[model samples]
Target: MDTSKVSSLEELKDLDMDFINDIGWAKVMWDSLQACLKKSFLNWVDTVLTMSQNEDDVKEWRSTFMEQFEDRCYELVTDIRELHEQVLVNIEKYLNKTQVLCKMLQADMPVIGQHKLGLYQEQFQLKRQMRELEQMVEARTSEVNQLRSKQLELCKNLGREPILIKDHPLPSLNEISDLKKHIEQLEQETFDRLEKFTTVKGELIEIINLLGYTPSTQFELAVITGEESDFKITEENMESLDLFLYNMKKELNNVKEEIYQLRTKIEQLWNMLDVDFVEREEFRKKYVGDSLNTLEALRLELKRCESLKRANIKVFVDRLRQELVEIWKLCHCSESVRYEFRFFDSDTYTEDLLELHEVQLKKWKIYAEENKDIIALLNKHHTLWDKMIELEQNATGADRYNNRGGKLLKEEKERNLLSKQIPKIEANLLDLAERYQLRYGVPFLTFGNTIESYINNLHANRENAKKLKLSARKLQKEATAINPSTSHMTSKRILTDCPSTDPKKYKYTPRKVFTEPKKNPKQLQVPKILLTTLSKSKRLSVERKKRLDKIRRLSRQKETRDSSTYIEFQNDLSNRVDLRSTINVAVDNETVVKENFKSPARQRGTTPKSVGKKSPNLPNKLTAVKSQIKLIF
Candidate 1:
């Protein structure tokens, strides 16, 4: 099996063979050791990091600095890209100038025409430009390569899992066998320790005996109160002896009944009789009499009691076992019966284990609590570390920018120093130009004005650049101040603004509507009897009175009241009206309202007569009589 040069998938067959021979079992052991090392490393790292406060105090400006650095990086990249384009253009310009110069030289080389000197000067300038281009290209390429490598490394490590194992060797079969043997030995030792717990039973018995000093028993009393110096008998406990004897007799009877049933079922009556006969005869002679007939009767009763007692004991033991099982379940613990059989031993192991558990429980609890606190610390520390890493990355990026800026300043200073030497060079070139003009009988060339104009432009550009920087800083400060307050309502502003218009206008002149928002109409007014227009308070009072009157009238109409009483109440209500009049009434024309009907005799003739011809006194007497009649009706 060759694993050294695996290029094809089919080579996996050979790799698998090698894996079986070299790496299969070894991998398991190596993985376990790796896991142990990883856990230890992580614990140590966590402990150290958790104890430090350096990572927890990262400044708030870290995020902003990171963003600014990223922006600056982009700016620098764009500048470098533009510089690259400019260098290409400069190179092309230099090449074109050289080509043009060569053509000029070719055209005038035999005669040395006026264009020859101009072309020569242009060629030299182009050559200098080419040198600068080449130098910048090399510098930019080096920087781009470094940047690309850093970016690649950053991307690769973004989500990479750490390799847990640094170095590990394979395990041999012998080592695996040894580990298995050691595990088996440990298990055997555990069993041996468990067997030592039987001593707990003896200790329990000793405790019970220590508490068994009951002076109420006749046997105990006899030992205490006997007349003989060696005899210990107590008169106070004599009655208790009778009760103990009675209970023993009852128990013996129960056991006998159980034995009889067992004998009947297994047909082992002879064996049962043998076990009971002699013991029963002695008990009979000791309790009743020494007579043979009396002993035989007592023996039979004793046999019956023993059988019954055995059956009762078995039943009681079964119930106790069921109750114990229920108790074990309630306590959520396995039954102690397993301990009695499996863990009991006649050694100190059980006691030692109990003591160990008592001590270790406290220690385990303390360690667990400490571990929880450490975990919390680690979590907080990790958060702080993440923030600090981001801050450090931003600070490093800024430092890089500052380095480049310093480099640019140094270059610019060198250029300025060279420009200072340029004046001497220019003076020498002017002297040569004047000699050429004198020799050729022409005017002198002039570049002094161009140099002064260029210097003036440089100063103006520097002043403009400073002003731009100051304005940018001021705008940034204002934007930051407004950002916190403006953030909440930006969405609302967008929604309220017309979609067709620009959003920037909304920041200054907010949209305004001429007409106010329409409100819901007032609730319908309840009817009032007093006036066409009334004060709200008066209207309410009048409406409330009308409502109460209407309610009272409706309620009266719904009831079954006596007709005479109801009629009297209605008359009183009409007579006792409290309405105030706005104007005094004048009786200008009085007319009496009268009800008439035809008599039974008049019905046949279909004729009626009026009683109107009367004296003034009679008229007054008739009016009084009519008033009494009207009132009665």
Candidate 2:
């Protein structure tokens, strides 16, 4: 029944025939089986041959395919070898390029680093040089300041107007050259002045030395010394010349007075000896020839006295003029003084002898009065100067050991008083100089240099203090503007004692709250009865209602106020508009009335009615109408 497993004819022939043999057609079944066997054997032979043919064909096809595959593989191997060579060539080229690049990079690194290092060094050198330049500038600035201070001091000492160094720029080449030329000119002038001054001084000294003798002897001695006077004075020796001249003039005046008295006594003696009280002719006859000789001698003495008076007066005037010129030069008087006194030439006295004498006496009196005033002023100035010098010296001296308490107090008080009085005195001196210059057209008491220096220092200090005050005010304003609140805090801190530095002692610390620990759900025990009896809902509801009522009341009040305000504003706006319109209408109506009634009489009658009825009541009626309208709205 499973016939699919049988394939060969031999297997088909080997099947069992028992079932067919038991049937009536066993021979027929055996014959049929033989026939089927023959047929199957033939079909098997054909199938075998066909299968053999197919196998041969498959083998040939496989051989041909293998041959084609071998050829393809060989060609692929050759192509692959060529590609490998090309790849090797490319790799070598890339390696060469890489080596070149590596060498180039290697060569460039040190050069770049060297350049960087050089730049760094240059920068460092520039910085160093800049620092040196800054230091040099600072030093130069300090030197300039010192020189400026010295210049100011010199100006004060020389009694000249101080140059404002701050106002000028540093001297340029041209300016410096010009200054050098000026300085050279000044030096030459100073040398010439010094020579002149020395000559005058020597002459004055010789005249003074000759004044010790009597007037008759003085003239002889003066003439002798004048010829022998070869003494050379200098700037250094001229310090005491003024004093010497003053003393010499006084001595000369005394000598002249003494000589005058002697001359008077001689005249009286001659008069007593001679009987010259009578007529000249009778006296000559009565006293023989002696009266005639006495008269001639008296006439010669009188002539000599007159000649002597003229010579003395001329010398005195010349000497006085020279002294005044020297004084003016020393004081550096203003241009006006120099111009006025430049030509001091005076005419010689040629009037009556007695009148000439009287004129000389008046001149002497005037000179004496001026000299006394000058001497008094000079004495006062010197006394003040001496007091100041003494105070300064005492201040600088070593402290005393014995009676220290009393002495120290006394010294301190004196120092304070001197400090207070010195400035006032100096101010007075300056005022005196100015007034004298204004009144006399010449400088007077313009002598002290120390006072000028003190005044300058005071002015400088005042300027510095003023600058500091301005700076302080600016700082205060900035501080107030920047942080107004912090200033108060800083002031408070300044007023109080210093805060403790200890970490434990803080100036201000936040307050701490000791909160109770939270209870756990399991630890909390609530009684069932209390939980059941809890009843705060009604109270909370009542509080909420009260809050709502308050909010509603406030809102209602705000609404009412807002409505009232709006109403009032509306009423005011309408009234203002109505007033403006009424004013405008009244102006237009007045114009119309003027135009309609052009005649002077008609215009006057209508203007009064218009002004009274329209102008005055217009604003009030408009306002009332606006109010009524507002009420209706």
Candidate 3:
């Protein structure tokens, strides 16, 4: 057979075994074996024989080699015996363990198949059993190794220690099961960690989104991307995630707070800018939610308002000041009261100062609203009181005598109305102020003084005026020796028209005496208007004789008026200038002016028929001066 022609080991072996029974093949094989033996031992021969003819040398080497071979063979047999014993021990132990597993498996699987299989020789059965056990061990070992690898991976992922068992030759059942249990536990832990990571990651992501932020780090990105296993799950890592979530929530809260404050700022700006209600309401409706986008929108709105405010700081400040003025008016605040605020006078158009003014205006507005009822009453009282004072002042005014078209009569009517309205309003004001003080634990103020205190001052001054008037009457009656019983009545009547004295403004001066100029007994003169109604004249019905006398006097006056024209025209016709205008002007200049020589008490003692009657000669003198002025012009 040609070895090169064989395609496989099985074919080669079959051919070699087929020639085993052939003598010719046996002769060739014997020759080859003899040559292979000679080749193997010839080198130990004395000279390494070149041919089989060297029998004597072969014999000498053969004797020495036989002895050495026997000695080496004995040593090899002894080592082999010991190795065989150790091998038997390992085999028996592995075999017993396998047999036990077989017995345990007997309940599930059975060997009740072919009779020939059971009829196998004892040694062959044991050998097959050992071989099968080896194969099973190999499979088990591979499985345990896989479990160990899985355990390591899981432990690493879980950020914990790995579990392992030593198996030198073959892994045992118990160790393999224990390792699987450890792997299972690690797997469970990994699952739990994954769950926790997923939960925390979701929370972190949700909070971050709510706060309108993005992931900035790889860990955060991993959480957001839902990569749970690649990351090591540990207490510290979870805590870090929790902390990250907490920080996001905190950021969201801060954003919400900022939004609230921004809305507040926008409201104040709206008031200062007088933003239309429609726009304000629309903006409020637009940015009503509490989401991050809402907060952002509100921030933008606030920024816009702030920009507008900065762009028109002066205009805004002026507008705010004007609002303050209106609010002050509502609150019944005094004009000088605005001086108490620095921003009210500040020229610096800064946001800080503007905010100050806004704050003040807001405060006053709240105050006005809170004290609405009281403010209304106070304003009403103030109006009536002012009118009353005005009418009273007009009582003694120099123009009091210029009443044309029933002007003085109208004033008296209004004065009487104010007198009626003022006390009622004042009473309401006082009641309201008392209630205010009771409710708020602070006094109602006017001109910086409490209402109660100011009212008391007025009352006290009125009482003092009454007492002073009574005293003045007693003194006058004692000096004049007037009827004592009637004097009190007359003084009380005089005092009824007198103004009450307030302690805040007190003054006193004596009345001036007016003595009539002595007139010629025989010369008829035009009757002078009495400074006061000196006495009542006797009344008598007009008779025919009196009527005729009055008509004769009127005719004489008519004749005189027909002869004399205007002073300047008469002078032109006569070609003679009169010097009387200059003399009259000098006389008027030398006369005592009421303000200089008279006092308020002088007018109080007089009871005139008409309140505003003028002197007769005074107008004629004024006309002469006017005519003189016309000639000069």
Structure candidate 3, residue pairs in collision? none
TM-score of every prediction relative to native: 0.12, 0.19, 0.34
How many backbone clashes does every candidate have?
Answer: 35, 0, 0
* Model 1 worst lDDT run, 10 consecutive residues: 584-593
Question: Cα deviation of 167 in candidate 2 (Å)?
Answer: 99
What do the candidate models score in CA lDDT, each in turn? 0.36, 0.43, 0.57
lDDT of 3: 0.57
Cand. 1 Cα-lDDT = 0.36
Comparison by lDDT, 1 against 3, better one:
3
lDDT of 2 by residue, 146-211 (tens): 555655544443334444443123443354345455445444645564565556557665654554
lDDT of 3 by residue, 235-302 (tens): 66777777777878788788888888888888878886789999998977887656677888888888
lDDT of 2 at 594: 32
Which RMSD does model 3 reach against the true structure?
A: 28.9
For model 2, give the 10-residue run with minimal summed lDDT. 624-633
Error of 3 at 582 (Å): 62
